[model samples]
Target: MKKLINNFTYITFLGYIAFIPSGPYPISVFGIKLDILLGLVLLVLILPKITQIGKNYPSIFLISLLFYLVTTLLSVIFSEDIVFSTSKWFSMLGYILVSILAPIAIDNYSKIKFSRLFLLVVAVVISFFIIHMALSYGLDKPQRFYLGFDPTAPANYQSDSGVEDIVDPNMTAIGLTLSVIVYLPNFFDSHHTKRRKTLEILAFAIITFGAFLTLSRTAILSFSLSLVLAFTMLSISSKSIQNILTQISKLFCLLLLVMIFLFGIYTLSPSFINGFFARIENIESGKEDRTDLISDTLSIFFSDNKNILFGQGYHITNPHNEFLRNLTSSGIFSLIAFLFFLYTLYFCILKKIKGNYWRYFSALSIYIYIYS
Candidate 1:
């Protein structure tokens, strides 16, 4: 019985990997791959005897979950886009599942294998994706099956960089994150294997370069945060080697920042990136719509309005941001649950792992949570 349960979990893991479409992340998976994680979560739930609750839930994860739950509920309540919010909830649930299973999946000894396979699949998928995109972009043609996002086109970036037909930076960012998480761990290689070490260096470079090409400032920021986290998680033979690694990481970050500035100057030509700057500056003005919507929705929620509390069938809500979206659809209580999920996971890493190699990932997730 134990073997069968374990087999089920592993199969679910494979299914998750196999579901990837032509790339490293889930912009596409937002459609087909959405349900698989939820399914796995449900599977675990069905056999509580097999999946220990304490091992799965941990304490820190439990706290962040509360915030997530509350945020989700509030967002749904105020979201003007109901259908969008419903779809988003699925994503939230998926992240939740990942948080629940990921720590458990790697536990003590498997972090290496899990990290390797994860990195390998991501590197392969994105490399193929970029190759496919490059061909289509170069040809200025799209075959029926070739689905791609080009930021350098008339739609996104046009003036400053002469970059049209570049892929969306966010999509690339998602793929890059997956790739980093997979390869950043030292466990994938052997102590004496020169080839593996070379691959590791090459892998990091490719992922970092690809991220630069995306020309996404926010994405770039996330990558920086993730890298610092990765470095923290890693270990070296001597203080000198560690210093070398640190210097290289700083140089990489500096170059990336320079590239982003140049790209911004080039692509946003029509408005000279000022328009870009203004748009970001405009975000503060939109809070009225958000706050007003939330305030109105709270009336329904507090008055025992079951319809609002349970969620309004998917159109009157979609709080726009992750925090707001959760509260409207799920409720304030659930919003807190979501936050608990995030913080608890952070706490788990800090509390559980005691190693030099884990510094990068440990500090990275916390940084992401901070910015998020």
Candidate 2:
């Protein structure tokens, strides 16, 4: 019965991951969002075994998490709108709980293997679904997939009325980004059969194409940086020149194949390519830039002495940068706590990279850091 419950908990956790991209969509039950619902269910399932779960995690991780949670809660007292801040605080708590508890449920080698396979399957499914939807009903004016959103609706109409479901392309891209990062190394693994390698390559191509459709610069940049960093780490860890040369050859071949695939996409949809380049051009031209927002966020963060300690509170503003967001939402202490938590978490994952199955987790940790 205990084993059965753990398996169920792990499956629920995977469901949470699968729906992470759909977070902004208005899919709900009894007015509760699906992701929140899954999280709540997961919390309930684990509560009975909370002590057991807690025992598995490191002391530093738990201590940092607790401190982070406490700081966020404390920030709520200083919020201008207590009700809204309280709601946001609860949401943050859910995310923290999910992050800490979900992976602990995947205890052994079998679960680790299955989790990777599940994420790969999810990546392929998401890519196919988004690409098919985009091709069939057509992309929005921005040539981006507006999945779970009413493409015809005005931005203000969707935002003000709160009736139309909205899906942020950037968030959707993040899901694909994670999926790609987690399974990308498999393509280079020599243990796989030829057929398996071919399938993995196909999946990678489809997912990469889907990520392109989102046209999220952050997602694209994160994926690129993570891939480069992952390879660099692998190369550094390699014991011999022959192994390093082999990695380089594989990377070159992969890049060539990706280029050809992208060329094929451009031939099929020149407009899409144009749109993507236009986005890049806009960013380069400062027409669609975050520098101003980030600048303003910094100003607000340091405006008052009280804000320096307790922050302005939740739902204050979207800083877009996680560190800035934390600094603005819960002040310096929360930021410190967050940094500590991240350090411990990354350190833990770093230690596990020596194991074969843990490499994917290490890659994921790198991807999350870059993405953030």
Candidate 3:
């Protein structure tokens, strides 16, 4: 029964990830969101192991997270709209719970392998769906397609209706970014079978294209920087000159293949290339900028002394910066807690760099830092 419970917990966790792209239009059964239902079920299954969850993690890291949660809760209590704040707080709690429990669910090599494979499959399906939606809506459509039940906007776009479940393009891009980074290291390794290599290459190409379709500058930048960080760390960890040389060669080959694939897509659809470069040019020309938004958010954050200690509450405005968002919404205490958590997390990943899952975690750490 214990074994069965573990299996159920693991499968439920996988189901949660698989439906992440469908977050906007969450599937429901008898009015309960499927993802939330799965999350609750997962929590119940893993409740017995809660005490053991912290055994492997750093105490400071856990402490900082607890502090962060407490500050967030205080913010929620002080919030004007308690319902909205409570909902948001619960969502965050669920995310934290899942992260803490994941190691227990996927405790072995075989489970890890299966989880990665599941992610690859999920990425491929989402990529293809995005591609098809883009083509259907025309590449020049004002709004990009997102990962959800429907790519098009709803007829009734009410903010509170809960039916206007349009997932953000940036969110979809981030998910694809993660999927790409996860399988990217396989290209550097030499032991994979030809079929495995081919699948990885195909998945990588398709996922990359899908991310490009989102035209999210942050996602693109994060993906690029994460790859560079991963490569640099791997190079530094290399023991011999020959291994370093081989890694360099592999990197060059991989970049060449990516360029060729992207060029082929450009030849097929020049509009996508034009649109992508136009976005970059807009930033360069100051046609699109976030400096004003950042400045405005800072102004509001500092407008009141009390706001500095215990924030003005959540979702006041779109800050577009995670640290600023936390500072403005939850106060300085939450911000410090969050920063401490990340600092410890970075060291935690560094210590494990020589371990089996170093490559994935290293890339993921960079991704999280950039995204945040």
Q: Arrange candidates by lDDT, highest first: which order?
A: 3, 2, 1
lDDT of 1 by residue, 1-372 (tens): 966856565556545553332232332243443335545554464444335546555655665665555556565555556667667666566556665655465354554456455655665566556545544454222221122454234324443533233334455555565555544445333463887677666665555545443433455566656555445444343268767677567557756865676475446343424443443465446753545666666665565655445544333444444555445556555555656665666556656554544444535554562345
lDDT of 1: 0.51
Better of 1 and 3 by TM-score: 3
| Cα deviation of 14, candidate 3, in Å | 1.6
Off by over 4 Å in 1: 18-51, 63-67, 74-87, 102-108, 139-169, 187-192, 228-342, 359-372
Q: If scored against the real structure, what TM-score would every candidate get?
A: 0.58, 0.86, 0.87
lDDT of 3 by residue, 1-372 (tens): 978877777888888777643323456777787778888887777667678867877887788788888988888877767788888888889777877877766688667656766777787788888898888888766565766546665323434546445567777787776765665444445777899888887887888888888777777777766665666667767788887787678668867886897798789778877888778677635735677777777887798876787677755546777888889888898788878887887776666554644465445545463544
Q: What is the C-alpha lDDT of each candidate?
A: 0.51, 0.72, 0.72
- Model 3, 77: alpha-carbon shift in Å? 3.2
Scored by TM-score, the top model is 3
TM-score of 2: 0.86
